[model samples]
Target: MLSKRRLTGTISNYRFYAQSLATASNSLLGELNDWETDGDLTTKIGKSLAAIITSLDALQHFKAEMKRSPLMPKRRNADAA
Candidate 1:
């Protein structure tokens, strides 16, 4: 029993979270790259890489859900905005 507005709000929040996750993953990957270059791949760096992989999986799932949801359009172009 969710109102349309609330549901849309939920989706918007999820999208925002997904974007944040992507940003975080990118940042982590950058750190990982730096670690690799320095040859200091410690346990913490490995853990961060693992976390990035997990987040990427979750991002794919959320992206698929967003595509399937009625609230999302099939295609969105930046120039269209």
Candidate 2:
């Protein structure tokens, strides 16, 4: 029974998290490329990539849930009244 505002806030938060995950994923990939010769560091970067992919999946699931929920109403003119 989440309120519209709460639901919207949840979606917004997830969106931010998704963006952060994407950024981290890109950074990790770059690091992996640079450290490919270092086996240990490259392995760690690969693990980080997997973690970020999982996070992105979770965020997408949250977004889908929000889309299925009947929370946000249709847009209305501010001065219609």
By lDDT, the best candidate is 2
lDDT of 2 by residue, 22-53 (tens): 88788787776878476578667877788788
Q: By TM-score, who's the top model here?
A: 2
Write out the backbone clash pairs for model 1. Answer: none
Candidate 1, residues 1-79, lDDT tens digits: the string is 3356855776676677677667766766777778747655576567666766666676676667666676655677889
Q: Model 2: residues >4 Å from true position, as ranges? A: 36-39, 72-81
Give the Cα-based TM-score of candidate 1 against the true structure.
0.47
Q: For model 1, what is the alpha-carbon lDDT of residue 10? A: 62
For each candidate in turn, the TM-score is: 0.47, 0.61
Off by over 4 Å in 1: 1-41, 75-81
Q: What range of 10 consecutive residues in model 1 has the weakest lDDT sum?
A: 1-10
